[model samples]
Structures are given as structure tokens and as C-alpha cells.
Target: MNPVFKEFKEFVNKGNVIELAVGVVIGGAFGKIVTSLVNDIIMPPIGALDRTDLSGLFISLNGTFYQTIKQAKDAGAPTLNYGLFLNSILDFLIVSASIFLLTRAFIRFQKRQVEAENADKICPYCISKISINAIRCPQCTSILEETH
Candidate 1:
């Protein structure tokens, strides 16, 4: 095999690189799901309350009025699609909140794992793992007492 190809293969075979590739794929799918949730599930009620269709909101730059964005586009009028911008902002917020929640949950899980692994008490004098009920440092033969 060519040396460059060999190096490329090694790079691609790395665990981090593989994990990153998987993350990218999953992130794309997750983004679509969040976008749908924002557009389909969340926005309709808010739009209804405001008596506005957010995705159809825009201003025609041609100094002509159109009932909707589609109408303006069909009439060959330039438009400032602020309603679509609002939808994009909503998508961003939803994605951000979802990532925040997942990160917080992952942190909590990691903390629990660490605590479980460190459940056994360590002897301060000998720096060895000791039973939680131990009254002496077994390795150094030092008496343990309640200092506080």
C-alpha cells in the first residue's frame, strides 16, 4: 500500500476519529429531530396565539405588498424573511437546550460512577484502600481515630 494511504488508514482507524465520525452522524440526525419538534410541535401553538404564521412572515423589498412569503416569491419580489429567521432562532435554541440537558445528565452519570469507584475509604497514613469500618490502618498499623 502507498505510505500516504497507510497513514490515512491509521488515522481513520483511531478510536477518537471513529467516535467523532459517529458523533457527527448522530448529531445530524438529532438536529433534524429537534428542527421538526420546533417547527411542527412547538411553533404552531405560539403562531396560533399571535395570529401569525411565522414561516410565512416576510417584508417585500420591492415596495409592494404580498399576503405571504410565497406570494412575494411568486411575484418576483425580494423579501426580508424575518419570520424564517425567527424559526431558525427557535431551532438553535431547542438544539442548545437539548445539548445542555444531555451534557448535564452525562456529567451526573460520570460523577456517580466516580463516587461508586471510590466508595471504599483510603487510609490516610498508608495511602491504601481500607474497609469503611476499619479502626486501624492495616498497611501501616496506625490507629485510626475520630479527629473531628
Candidate 2:
């Protein structure tokens, strides 16, 4: 086998690469959801306010006026589509916010689990709840072993 192929094989076998592949697949699906939210949900209200479809909103600098975006593109007219840019920005913001919220919730859940585990420490003889660092079991008066 070529040295490059050997290195590639090692890279593909790594846990991080597998995790990243899974993340990419999930992110792609998440992106489509965000795109739909931006295109269907968010833009519709904005379009109603502006009295024009966001996808149709554009400015052609040339004297030639286009009835539609396709016509403008076919005519090779220079144009600025601010509405599309706005939609893209909204999509990015929505995706970022969702990922941020999910990560925060996961962190909070992990912290709660850790706290619950800590609360389970008990005096061996008395069966009463006790701090992990207790020198002796307060209820039973038994010596505590150093866990560390």
C-alpha cells in the first residue's frame, strides 16, 4: 500500500473522523430545517409587510427592467438581491441559536446528573446521607476511608 493510503486509512479509522461524519450528516439535516424556517415561516411575514416576495426583491442597476429574477438572470443584468442576503442571514442566526440552545441544555443535564450522583454519598453504617469529604459518618460514628 502507498504511504498516503496508509495515512488515509488511519485517519478514517479514528473516532474523531467517525464522530465528525455523523455531525456533518446531522448538520446537513439541521441546515435544511433552518432553510425551510427562513424561506417558509420567517420570509412570508416579512414579505407580507414589504408587499413583495423576498425572493423577488432585487435591484437591477441597468436601464432594463426585469419582470422576474429568471428573466433578469437570462438577460445578464447586474443586480443586487438584498432580500436573499437577508434570508441567508436569518437562516444562519436560526441554526446558530438552535445549536447553542441544545448544547446549553445538554450541559445543564450533565451538571444535574453530577449533582445527583454527589447527593448519593452516604454513611456506610448509618445509611444517612453524608458529604463525600466527611472524616467520619456523623450518624453512625464510624471512620470514613479516603476515597482519593
Candidate 3:
């Protein structure tokens, strides 16, 4: 095998690369779910409240008036589709908020896992983390008394 091909094989076989590939697949699926939620579930009530179908909202640039985007397109008028833009903005906000919440939860979970694994003690003098069995604070070089 060529040296470059061998190197590429090694790189592709790495755990991080495989994990990233899985993440990409999951992210794509998650994107579809978010898009559906925005279009079907979230937008309907908003459109009802606004008394306007968001997808049909547009402004004609040719000074020709049209009731909806489809009408404007049918009439061969240039339009600014602000309603569709609004929907896209909503989708982005929803996806961003979901990712933020998930990342925050994951961080909290990781912190708990780390704390559980360490089972260490904090030095009273220096407030530094040390082994639970340590009799002295390594950071401050202070003697530690055993607490019953």
C-alpha cells in the first residue's frame, strides 16, 4: 500500500474520527426533527396569532400588488420573501436553544461523573483538591487533621 493510503487508513480508524462520523449522522437526523418541529408544530399557532400564513408573506418589488408569495411569483413579480425568512429565523433559534440546553445538560452530567470518580478531598487551607487519604495539604504545605 502507498504510504499516504496507509496513513489515511490509520487516521480513519481512529476512535475520534468514528465518533465524529456518528455525530454527523445524528446531527443530520436531529436537524430534520428540529425543522419538522418548527414548520409543523411551532409555526402554526404563531401564524394563527398573527392572522397570516408566514410562508406566503412577501413584498413585491415591481410595484405590482399580490396577496401571497405564490401569487407574486405567478404574476412574474420580484419579491422579498420576508415571511419565509422569519420561519428560517425561528428554526435557527429553536435549534440553537435546543443545542444550548443539551450542551449544558451534558456539561452538568460530565461534572457529576468526574466528581463521582475522583472521590477526593479539598484542602481547607488552600482549597485545593487532594487525595482523600492525604494528611497534609500539598498546595499550602499545611498539616491536616483527620475529621471523625
TM-score for each predicted model, relative to the true structure = 0.82, 0.75, 0.75
Tens-digit lDDT track of model 2 for 1-148: 9999999999898649989989999999999989998898888898899787877878886978888777888999988887788788889999999999999999999999999788657776888988887888888889988774
* Superposition error at 7 for model 2 (Å): 2.4
TM-score of candidate 3 to 2 decimals:
0.75
The Cα error of candidate 2 at residue 37, in Å, is 1.6
The alpha-carbon deviation from the true structure for residue 41 of candidate 1, after best TM-score superposition, in angstroms, is 0.8
Candidate 1 per-residue C-alpha lDDT over 14-106 given as tens digits, one digit per residue, 9 for 90 to 100: 648988988999999999998899889999999899988798888999999999888999999999999999999999998999899999999
- Looking at model 1, the pairs that clash are none
RMSD of 1: 3.4
Clashing residue pairs, candidate 3? none
Candidate 1 or 2, higher lDDT? 1
RMSD of each: 3.4, 4.8, 6.5
* Candidate 1: 10-residue stretch with minimal lDDT: 139-148
Q: Candidates sorted by TM-score, descending order?
A: 1, 2, 3
